[model samples]
Target: MDVELFKDGKRLDGRDVEDLRKPLKLEVGVLQKANGSAYMEWGKNKILAGVFGPKEAIPKHLANPERGVIRCIYTMSTFAGLEDHGRMGPNRRSIEISKVMREALENVVMLEKFPSTIIEVYVIVLQSEGGTRVSSLTAAAAALMDAGIPMKEPIAAVAAGKAGGKVILDLNKDEDNYGEADVPMAFTKSGDIVLFQMDGKLSKEELETAIDYGWKGTEKLFELQRKAFEEEYSEPLDKKLRMVE
Candidate 1:
């Protein structure tokens, strides 16, 4: 809303407008009953993802004996934000996002190993600060791992935005609202892009720069995911050793 007022290219959180909010907390196996579950928060954006199966397919029409099907359901909670109208049932946006997410994840998961089973990924947005899709993707990967699904590798996502003619790493709500362009991508640890999408317009040079920025951001984000998983499993063992001592 106030694009002209963002002087010195500074954001509300003191980030250089090109800086991304490092993921705050990432947890896996958060939902005890689910086959796999994860919750992650990036700045004010919060997301939760759960995975069920590699089990029998629910809708037989979508099933195939040669590969496992990826079923994704994307929904934002009623309290996701004040601006998001509370409406039940799947919307066009959710359906589109679900399709994108499914494609992104299918590339890495060893779906053929399951054969005819279904892997259902459900993403729930608890808060929407911006970059919700990227946040959801990160959570989905973590949840899939927690469920012990066979995956070629874990994946992470990052958003690159253009502000003041400079490509930035991540744009929060305010910057995104008025920024010139936004690009979000999901990548594997091996530096492969599994999903890519963008909005707004940009020059070829700027687009290349944004893509570079997004890749760099993803590297750092992957480390955060790994650390979180380590910490979750490490803490209990450390406490048990301390008790024995």
Candidate 2:
């Protein structure tokens, strides 16, 4: 039997099969024309998100009389990758992602503040090496803050992978694809998880371990998000908004 060990009996690029790489970067207020926007890069995964309104609702039926409504659109950019499909358009995958994202966000935002208004969130996946959903969630939260939308709390999301029988935090592309399990979690800065998803099979113990990794990773991400949020408020953002990311 030819057994290719990931890294000395661990998964490839090992750090206990679940240990993730460092160097996560987030940029807030990237789109000058949008009411609020942000970009996030986690390893090779990249996502750009924009938040618009509390604007007057469009299509009379879509309007709500008691609370503001949220509409989320998620799409993949053409240049995100050329390895497989080259075309870009609304597909089943994008539709499902958009719906889930909207549900996740609507849970925390204060919609009652803007009744009869619409809050639009657009997430464009620039790269989808791994954990794109988590990245989108994190980016959306940042964009919402930039737009000055009041939320119950800031949400931070991260993915955990189990490789070589070990749980790792924040899986990159290869780890996510080849790993035994993938678990993504979204949480508030206060340590409350609001959204969770899992792929592949896992024992109860394994699931707990994955959740632990996700929580730790989310905490790490929260600090970066906070810093980004503060920088936007410190001064007027230039075109590049290249001040202290």
Candidate 3:
């Protein structure tokens, strides 16, 4: 952990403190059977998200007579972080992540449309380097849109932290591991902060600095989500030009 993470305001990977990783890719409607699906590759992280139901809420009790429910399950393949401490099945970390992810998604969905139903979202991490939650959130939002779910708008995810004694944006695995503080967040187009979580330690100023970076990064991330949807829904230049989404 003593290794220097930054040199002259640039990370070891040669990225500026506020820059997002390059070669990010996203695909929507990747699964045929699922109502909606998306695949996202961000940095070294590979994540897949699928949406199901809106049919009926299982067990009845989890359903609300007045509205629908959102059930999210976030899991990592055993090999995803196996080299670092991945578990065989759902553990405390996975359970907690699922809860928080569900809350973030619920903020943008119009649950009232499917009364007494459940919209199930599953996000699986096939690989990891860091920032998996944010990546998962980005993919899940696209999958929901692919499923034609009613939504207020799309949201994006970004993370920032204090690493190498400097506040940096979009942390990688190494920085997240060795950094003094980490904050992952989700944001809406209206600038509403839907998801926020902090790990490690930071002073008030450091926290604010990290969050500011996160907000800035989210602006671009949200566009990536939209781009995925547009590509998937866009018709070939032959028949109908483009579908209004």
Best by TM-score: 3
The alpha-carbon RMSD values of the candidates against the true structure, listed in the order shown, are 4.4, 4.1, 4.2
Write model 2 residue lDDT over 1-245, tens digit each, in one string.
23343666655555555455545788898897788999998777789999999999998789999999999999988878537646778899888878878888988899999999999999999877878888899999999988999999888888886755677788777766677778888888788888888888889988888888788888878898999878877896674444564
C-alpha lDDT values of all predictions: 0.84, 0.82, 0.88
Model 3 lDDT, residue 133, Cα: 91
For residue 224, give model 1's deviation from the true position in Å: 1.2
Error of 2 at 69 (Å): 1.2
Residue 214 CA error for candidate 3 (Å)? 0.8
Candidate 3, superposed: residue stretches over 4 Å from native: 82-88, 235-245
TM-score of candidate 2 on Cα atoms, chains taken together: 0.90
- In candidate 2, clashing pairs total 5
On lDDT, the leading prediction is: 3
TM-score per candidate, chains pooled: 0.92, 0.90, 0.92
> Residue 22 error for model 3, in Å?
2.2
Write the number of the candidate with greater lDDT, choosing between 2 and 3: 3
